[model samples]
Target: MAWGPQSTPDYRFGRSKNTQRYSAPPGVTLLGYASPEGAGDAIHHYLRDHEAQVRRGQQVVRAVQQLINQGITPDITVTHPAWGEALFLKTLLPKAHHIQYCEFYYQNQGADIDFDPEYPSSIDGHYRSLCRNATQLLSLTQTDACISPTQWQCSRYPIEYQHKIKVVHEGVNTLFLTHKHWPTKSLRCSIILLILLTWAKRHAKRLLNASTSKPLPYPSGLI
Candidate 1:
């Protein structure tokens, strides 16, 4: 069951059959403090924007509480903590195992914010980035486990938190990558050669028996 913003998924994008959303009251703005004028203003805007996150967290907490009141307790809770939805879930469900998706950890200097030479980050920009990471940092501390899609991404987080984070690929679409019904005979000779090279290397024992010294049927030059 999804607990998020109250809106129907556009079929153009696709939709989940089951979702439980908690929308903010009308007129509430999404939390954002990206572009601030000065450090002081940055802090002020950051705090103001965070208030919205707090509200969202409260909404989710209330929803979870209601679910518990109705005798529904999830065994495991998975969440993408990049936003604040996972903020207070542990508080409500102490026994549940929470696995947070650690998509990114913002670093002002060595990361994306400053990588663009033409658009160097300003002092205020750096402050805003730090503020943006506040919720994610808090969520990390609360999560029972964290999954990062790559080692490079997991490395971006603090050393202390790395122990709780595991590097695991979200996975690729095998249907698109390997499930296509392509005719091996119809494939170009070059394409066929590449596949055979991989197949021979993987199945060397089967390809190279005591009867032959060579492991592959194709010429070494082609491979």
Candidate 2:
């Protein structure tokens, strides 16, 4: 967890800097690094988030190095590409099968940002939004393959790289739903949009109806 809540300083990335091995899950190891102060706070700089990810990756590299020192090398490495800890991972584990999750790719205009006049997107904002996808693009080259949740979502990626992404939706487990068993947690995973007042007013009415309606009967998870 190089750049998430776990990696925040004064948090799970404790001063101990020790590798966390979970016994309950038996041999499940988790490595966390302290994210640099103000690492993700800036949006004006195009490389701002990417640079932060590289800094966090350095710490992860050191942690993995310790394992390498012990002659412990993994045959596979599952990572979140957006976290930036994956920056130098291929260099470190050249032979490992690396898999990254492919969520929605961002764009400055026509997609999420600059879609409405009420909420104007500045040139800097557009640049930042477009530039934020740098890490994802680099990951496309570095990773062995990718996993996407939906065909429509997978289609959002570049045409050439779409082949690398396999759609694996987390469909509701019907048996589990029938049994009323539900998992307590789901790890990280959204869309952004701008609104015109006319559409917003119509959407609000529909939203109210949706909100008042009963929640979905099924949750995503193991069957």
Global lDDT of each candidate: 0.61, 0.63
Model 1 lDDT tens row, 1-223:
2332334211110011212133434643222122222234444775654555665566666656665686656556667676666788888878778888888787888665675464577999789878877878778888899888888789988898999999987666566767455555733343223323222454456443522545445343233
- Provide TM-scores for the models: 0.59, 0.64
lDDT of 2 by residue, 82-192 (tens): 667577778988887777888677766665667656568888887888788888787678988889877866887789888888899766657667744644665432122
RMSD of 2: 10.5
Where model 2 places Cα greater than 4 Å from the true spot, the runs are 1-24, 37-44, 115-117, 174-223
Span of ten consecutive residues with least summed lDDT in model 2:
6-15
Residue pairs that clash (backbone atoms under 3 angstroms), model 1: none
Which predicted model would earn the best lDDT?
Answer: 2
Model 1 TM-score on a 0 to 1 scale = 0.59
